[model samples]
Target: MGSREWSIEKRSDSFKAEVLETLSETGCLSVIVLGASGDLAKKKTFPALFNLYRQGFLPADEVHIFGYARTKISDEELRNRLHGYLIQEKNPSPQHSEDLSKFLQLIKYVSGSYDTEEGFKRLDKEISQHEILKNSSEGSSRRLFYLALPPSVYPPVCKMIRKCCMNKSDLGGWTRIVVEKPFGKDLESAENLSAQIGELFDEPQIYRIDHYLGKELVQNLLVLRFANRFFLPLWNRDNIDNVQIVFREDFGTEGRGGYFDEYGIIRDIIQNHLLQVLCLVAMEKPVSLKPEHIRDEKVKVLQSVLPIKDEEVVLGQYHGYRDDPTVPDLSNTPTFASVVLRIHNERWEGVPFILKAGKALNSRKAEIRVQFKDVPGDIFKSKKQGRNEFVIRLQPSEAMYMKLTVKQPGLEMSTVQSELDLSYRQRYQDVAIPEAYERLILDTIRGDQQHFVRRDELRAAWEIFTPLLHRIDNGEIKPIPYRPGSRGPAEADELQAKAGYVQTHGYIWIPPTL
Candidate 1:
C-alpha cells in the first residue's frame, strides 16, 4: 500500500526562517546513511532530504550529505542513480539542475561493510573532509547518523561508529543516531539490542523512529485530547465501551515475500507502528511534553496491556502468500492478525482494546474506533441499537467522525445515526500534511526525541506479543484462512461478535485506496 499518512507543507515563513537561523547557530550536519542504497533510503530518505534542501530547510552551502554502502559505483553513476530516485528526471524544475548539483556537491559515497574498523575509519575520514565538519565550531561537528539498514546490522554499525568514528573528547557538538523499525524479534531481543546499542550511545543520542508518530493527525492525538475539553472526559472505560485500532494494507509481500514471510503482521507492524498509535490513544497525560515525560506515559500504557490469551487472539494468512506463483509455496506466514488486548489500569479496566492489522486484505485502512457505553438506560425501546462511537481515520479519509443517535424528524420517536464529521480535506483547504519521513528527518536534526520510540517502550511492546510470535512459529497455532478483498478471516468477525460488537449498519469503511 502507498504511504497515505504524511504530506509536506512548506513551513510558514517565520518557521522556515527560524530553522535556517538554528542551522547557522548550531553548525550541525547529517552523515553517511548506513543503508544508502536500500529501499527506504532510495524511496523515502533521499526524497525527503531533497525536499528539505529544495525548500531551504537546510542552508545549501553549509549542509553536507554522505552515503555509505557496500556496492561500489562511480560518483557520476551514483549521482545519476540518486537523481532517478529523487526526481521525475523529465520536466524538471528550472531550479532542479542547480539544486541537484548543489546536493551532489554535499553528497559523497563510501563503500564498505559497517561492521569493519576499516569501514568506520573510511566513513569518518570522508565526513571529516566535508566543509561542515572541517569548519567545526571549536568542537566535533554535530552529527546525525541515519541507519536505514536491517535490524541485524544495527548493533554492529553502532559499535563501529563508537569505536572508530565518534570524537567524544572533541569540543564538537554531540552525535545522534537514527534507527529504523522492527527493533527486534521480541521483547528479549529488543532489550538486548537496546542494551548493546546503549553501550555505544547514550539513550538521549539514539532516536528510534516510528514514522506513524510523525503524522499530523497522529501528533494531533495529544492536542485533540488535552487541548480540547470534549475527548478527555469520555476517554476512560467507564464511558467508552471498546476501542478498535485497525491498520490494514492492500498489497501482499509483492517481491519481498522471501524476506517478509519470515516476520508476519504482528512483528512487522503491530509491535512498533500500531502499538505506538495505541499508546498515544490510551496513554495517561504527561505532566509536560518533555521527551522522557511523554515516553514514560507511553511505556506505562504498554506495560498496562493485559496478557493476551490464545483464545482471545486470532491469526490469518492470505491464501496467495502461501501458494501463489508470486510467493513461495512453503510460506505459511500470516499476513493478518487480530487480537483483543485489555488494559488493567483503572481508566480502562474491563474495556476491550481490539487491535487488528493485515496486508493484502479487503482494503488499505488505518483507523481507531471508540465505542462509547450505551446512553445510560436508553429511553428508546429498540434493544439492538447501542450508543454512539467516535472514530479517527488516519488514512484514506484522514478525518474524524462521531456517530450519535438523534431523534427522527417525524412524529414517531424513532432514532437515527448522525455523524459530526471533520474531513481533513474539506476543513484544511489547500493545506498539505507533511510527509512522515520529512517530519522525522527534520526532528532528528532538531534533536527532538519525543515522537520516537524509546528502548523501554520498545521492550514493553515486544513483551506483549512475544508469546504470540513463539506460538505462531512453533506450530502451536494455525492461521485462520482469509481471502483477498475481504475483511479478514471469519475468526476476526467472530472475535468482535463474541464480545457483542456488530459492524454498524450504515457507516463507511474507507481504507487507503492507493
Candidate 2:
C-alpha cells in the first residue's frame, strides 16, 4: 500500500526524489515483532504481514519475519498459533491452504526480555545470518522492529534494538522502528518517552503509528479537499456552521477495563485519533503534498487550537463500568466525552470542532459530520427541513454522503432532505480495501511519514489536552453516569446544542441497496 500510495504522480518533485532514493536500496526486508507473544502481534501484526505476503507485496524471497518475546515458544508453536488466529479472523478460507503454509514458513520465533542484551544479541545473529544469505557484498539490508509491547518498555527495548539489532551493512542500509501509542498519560510523560527514543534513533527512522490516519476515508480527505474546486470557497468559517468528529462503541471495556481505566475515553480516543482527524479537516492547504509539508500544516492546526472551555465539555461513565473487578469502585474515569475545540485561525475561527467518543453506546461507528450554514435569504424555506451536512463514515460501512434540501418528488412545493452518496462497499464491491495496519506497516518499509505522527505534531496535540487531562486526573471534573446501551449523559447533547450543532431530525442516509 505504501509503495503504491507514495508513487502517485501528484507527489512533489522533492518527495519523489527522496522516495526514489529509498527505493534504490533493494535490500532484503526483515520485520521483527518485539512482543510477538502478545494478542496485538497475533491478531494484527502477523495477520497484516500474512495479507501482504499473499498479495505479493512482501516477496517470499526478499522478506523474512522474526517473532521475539519471553514466552519461550518454539518456531513451530508460534506458527501454529498464527495459523489459528489467521483462520479465526480470515474465516474458513482467505486463501488456498498451500499459500497459507508457505507464508507461515517465513516466520521464526525467539524468546527475549525487552531490556536484556543477551536475547537481543541472539536475535541480531539470526537477522544478520538471514541478511548475509540473502544479499551480496554490494547489496544493502533493511530491518524493521515493531514494538508491540507496552510504552513502559519502549526505552529499554529501543536501546536494545539500537545496540544489538542495527543493520550490519553500511551499503545504504537502514533500521526503522514502529511504536504504537497512547504516547503518554499527558504532555510531560509523552515528551519524556519521546526524548528516550529520540536518543536511540533519528526522527525520520521512527514511525509513530496512528491507525486512524491509515483508514481509507481518512487518507482520502486531502484528495477530497484539495483536488476538488467546488469546496474551496465553502469550506471555511463563513459557510460552515459546525464540524463533529465522533466515535462510538456498543460494548463496554469487557476485558480491557484495567487498561481503559488509566487513560479514559479522552486520552484513549479524543486526544489522539479524533484530534489527528481534526487537523486534516481544518488545516489550510499545504505548500506541497510532500510528507514534511503536510505534517507542518497539521502542526499549525494543533498549535492554533484554543484552550477548551469547561462549559463546552461533557464527560460520562456507563453505569456498569465499575462492575469490572479491575476498575476502582470510585473511579472518575470517563467512558464517554464530548469536547468542543475552537481553532484560533482565521479560516475556522468561530466554528466549533466538536469531538465525541464513547463506550457502551446505542450504536457503533466513527464519522465526521460537517454541517453547512443554512441558506441565506431563503425563499424555499429549506432551513426548516435541516442544514446541509456532509458526512464521512469511517467504519462498519465506509461512505460519504451529502445531505441537502430538495423539492419533494411529485409536485407540492415542499422541501425534503436528500443525499448524494458514495458507499465504498456498494460502489467498489470487487476491490478489496486493505486493512489500516497493512498500509502503515508497508509504509514503514517504504519510509513514508505522511500518515504517521511527528514529534512536534504530537507535542502540540498533547499540549491542547494535557491541562484538561490533569484536571480530570485530579478529580476537579467528574463523569456523569449513564446507562450502558444509551447515548451517554444528557449533558453531552446540551453541550452540543450550545456549541451550535443543529441535529437534523427525521433524516437518515441509508446505503444504496446492492
Candidate 3:
C-alpha cells in the first residue's frame, strides 16, 4: 500500500486497539535514575525523560526526577553534564532554551553507594519529600526506578529498592523498575538474575527493555503484517524465499571496549535486538493485540527455531581491535557474527532466517530483506530480471519498500527492478520521530508490556543461542579476522551463497531526504 493510503491517520483504527488503556490513574510520579553519571544515563535515559517532559507528557509541577549515583557532584553539575547531551542543537531558539531550563529544574541528584542501605534510605527520603509536597491530598504517588547501571549491580539495587524505596501502601501508587538489555551472557545466568528480581517484585512491575521493540519501524511491523491485507497471503514460505535481518555499524568501539569486549557482538546485539526483530518477522498472528497475547506469539516462534549449527555460523573479529586500551590484549571476542535460524513451523518450515550483525564494518545500517520466490513462468527474455524483495529499513532512515520487476520504459520491453516505496521522511516530514528510549520509557510509565520483553520470552531466546555461545566461549572455535572497514569475513559471503541468497552487484539504496 502507498504511504498516503496507509498513513497512520487512515489506519488509526486498526492500530488503536493496542493502546486502549491510558495511564491516568497514576498521580504525582517520581522517576529515579540509578548510575546517573554513567554513559547510558547521560546519552539515552536523561535525554528521553527530558523529551517526555518537553512534550508535556509528564505533569510539569507534580513530576519530579532524581539522579542517583556514587559521584559526589552538586545538582547543578549533574544538570550541566546532562544539558550537553539533551536535544539542544547549536543556536537553539529562546523558547527551546527556556523549556530546557524548566526541565532541568525538576531534576535533583543523590550520591550514594549501591551496596549501602544508608544511601538508599536517604534517597527514599528525598523521594518521600517530593511526594508530600505534590500529593498532599492522599492521592497515590508513583515511583519508577530506572536501572541505568550494569548487570552486576542489578541484584543489590533491586533488593535496596524493595527494602527502602518501594511504595509504602498499595492504596496510593505502585512502583515499577526499568532495566536495559544484555539481560545475561547465557540462559542459566539470565534465569538466576530473573529469580533474584522475581523474589522482590512481580513480573508486571519489571520492565525488561529491548529498545529495538520501540523503534518506529519495528513498532510498525504489526500494523504492516496483521493490519494490512496486501501482505497476508505472501508472508509465508510458500512465496517467500528467505529473510535476512542485518545490522552493521561503521565505527569501532574506541573507548567502550571494556563492556563490548566482555559481551561481544553476539551478546550485545544478536541475542537481544536482532533476535527480537526476527520474532516479529516470523511470529504467527496473535489472537489479540494485548501485551501478553502478542508476547505469547513471539515466544512460539522462538521455540520453533532449531538449534544453530556450528557450521552455519561465521564469526569474525575486526583487525586492530587489540589496539584499544580497554580491550584485553589476548581477547578473542567476535565483533561480527552471521548465524542461520530455521523455524520448523507450518508457516516457515523451509525458509531460512539469516541474522547478521557487526561493528566497524563498511556501512552503518539496520534492515530486514525478505526475498520472494521467483516467478513460476516468464514470457519476457530478460537477463536482468530480479526477484521480488520486500525491504524494511529500521535505522539511518525508516522506510518500507517492495522491489518488483517491471517492463523497461522503452520499446525494448526488458524487465527492470522498480519499487513501491514508503519513506517516512518524505511521508511524515513534519512529525518528529521519537527516540526508541522515549517510546519505551513511556510504555513503562503506562504499564504497557507489549513492547518490552517477558521473562519466558527472554528464556526462549536464550535457549536458541546459548549452546552456540558456550561453544565460542569454551575455545572450541576461533573467530576469523577482518579489516575494520571491510564488509566482514570472506566466509560470510560464502555462507550466504550456500543459503541461496543472490547478490546483485552495483545496487545501492539512497535514503530519502526530508
Candidate 4:
C-alpha cells in the first residue's frame, strides 16, 4: 500500500525535487557488492540477489552484478564460494540447476584496495563497458553499491566511490549506496560520520539499513495501529501501563566476543533495532503514507524522548563471557541491558517504554509487550487473571496475540486468562516470509525510504544514549554478573517492578497448530 507515488493533490515542491533525483526504474542495473569476499556478502547479500534473479526481478539481459573487494579472487572463484551459501529449495524443478548456472554467470568480480582510485577506476570502467553495450552510452545506468563491510573502513570506501565510481549518466541515471549499521559509537562520532558521507551524497542517496525494520511483524505495526478503528481510541498512556520491547538470545556471542565487547548489548540491539520499534508503536498517525511523512513522525517521537536517568537502567555481563580469548580480562561491557525510555509527548507522558536486550539468556526471541492499565472498578476481579497485554512476537514463530480476561468454560463465574491469537504459520500456511535482507534490498532498488533510517532520526537516537554510553565507558558504571542460560541480573526485574510493570505469572503463549 505504501509503494504508490505521492498523491498528485499533495505534492510539495521539495518532494518533486527529490523524486527527480532518483534513477529511472527502467535503466540498465549494475549492482556492486563491496567487501564481497566477506561473510555478509556471501551469506546474505548474494543470496538475496539470487532470489530476485529466480523471481525475474533481475532480467538476465539488463542486470549485471559486480563483486568488488581486495580478495583477489576470480569471478568464477567468487561464484563457487557463494554457490554453497544459497538456501536450496526443499523441492527442486527440472530446470533449477540450469537457472542457477545462468545466474552465476551474470556476476563479475573486480579486485582492489578500498582507499585507492586504482580499484574504483577499474570498477567504473567495467560498469561503463556494460552500460555502453546495453545502449546506455550516455550514462543512463542505475548503479547500486552495497557495503557489506566493517564500519572502520566505510569512510575510505565511500570516498573512493565518490571519487572514481559514480555514474556519469544524467538522463535518469543515478548512484546510491547502502550502509550497514553501527553508524558511529556516539553522538559526536555519529554526526562526524554523517557529515563525512553527506559531503559525498545527498541524504536521499544514502540508505542506512536496520534489518529489524524489515521483519514481517515490525512492518505490520503502522497498519495494525492506524488502520484498525478498535485501537484508535485506546492506544495512549490512559490505556497502557508499560511497554516492554525485549530481545533475548540463548547462546553467547559465539565467535563474536571481541567484536561484541566493543559495542555492548545496548549498542548492538536497543539503540537501533528496539528504539525504531518504539517509535512506530508510539508515534501519531502520519498525514499520508509517503516516505517523508512517515519518517518525519518518527523523528519527532525520538526527539521528544527525555534523557536517561541512571537509576532506571540495569546492566549485566554473563558469567562465561570472558572465557572467549578475544574478550579482555577486565572488560566491563554489558551483555544485557534494560533501559526505560520516557517520551515527553502527550500520548505517552508518565508511561515507561522499557527496552530490554541480552545475549546468553534463557531463550531466543524478540518481542513487544504492551500491558494495559487495570480496570477502574473490578467487578469480575480480573486483576487475579492479570492485566491485559498485547504481545507481538518477532521470531522463532511470527505471531501477535492479546491476553484478555474471560470466564472459565465451566459453571464457575471466575475470570481466566485467554488470548486472541494470530499465528502467521497457522493463518497463512502457503506464504513464506521473505528474509529481512531480501525485502530491504528490494526497497533500495525501488527507491523506497519508508523502511530505511533517516539522518535526523539517527541523530536523535544517538542523543538519547550517548551520555549513558560514556558513563559505562568510564568507570562510573559497572555491569553486574549473571549466570549464563539464566535471565539477566535479578536487579533488572526489580527495576521493572519498581517502574509499574506487573509480570503475569504462569501464562505462556502456545502457537495453535494444524
lDDT (0 to 1) per candidate: 0.80, 0.90, 0.88, 0.89
Q: What is candidate 4's TM-score against the reference?
A: 0.94
Pairs clashing within candidate 1: 7-433, 7-434, 7-435, 139-171, 139-172, 140-171, 140-172, 364-511, 364-512
Distance from true position, residue 434, model 3, in Å?
0.7
TM-score of each: 0.92, 0.95, 0.95, 0.94
- The runs of at least 3 residues in candidate 1 whose Cα sits more than 4 Å from the true structure, single-residue gaps closed, are 1-11, 88-92, 96-101, 132-134, 168-172, 324-330, 380-386, 407-414, 509-514
Using lDDT as the yardstick, the better of models 3 and 4 is 4
Over 1-514, each residue of candidate 3 has an lDDT whose tens digit, in order, gives 5576567545554433333323345567889999999999999999999888776676576689999999999999999999899856798788888889999999999999998898899999999999888753343778999999998899999999999998887765889999887898999999999999999999999999989999999999999999899899999989998899999999998888988988999999999999999999999999999999999999999999998989889999999898999998888789999999999999999898999999899999999999988777666643245677899999978899988777779887667777888999897875678899989998887788999999999999999989999989887778999999999999998998787677654356677666
| Clashes per candidate (backbone, < 3 Å) | 9, 0, 0, 1
Q: Write model 1 residue lDDT over 425-479, tens digit each, in one string.
A: 7766556567788988888887789999888788888888998888888888878
lDDT of 3 at 445: 79
Local lDDT at 56 for model 3: 63
Output the worst ten-in-a-row residue range by lDDT, candidate 4.
1-10
Which pairs clash in model 4?
139-169
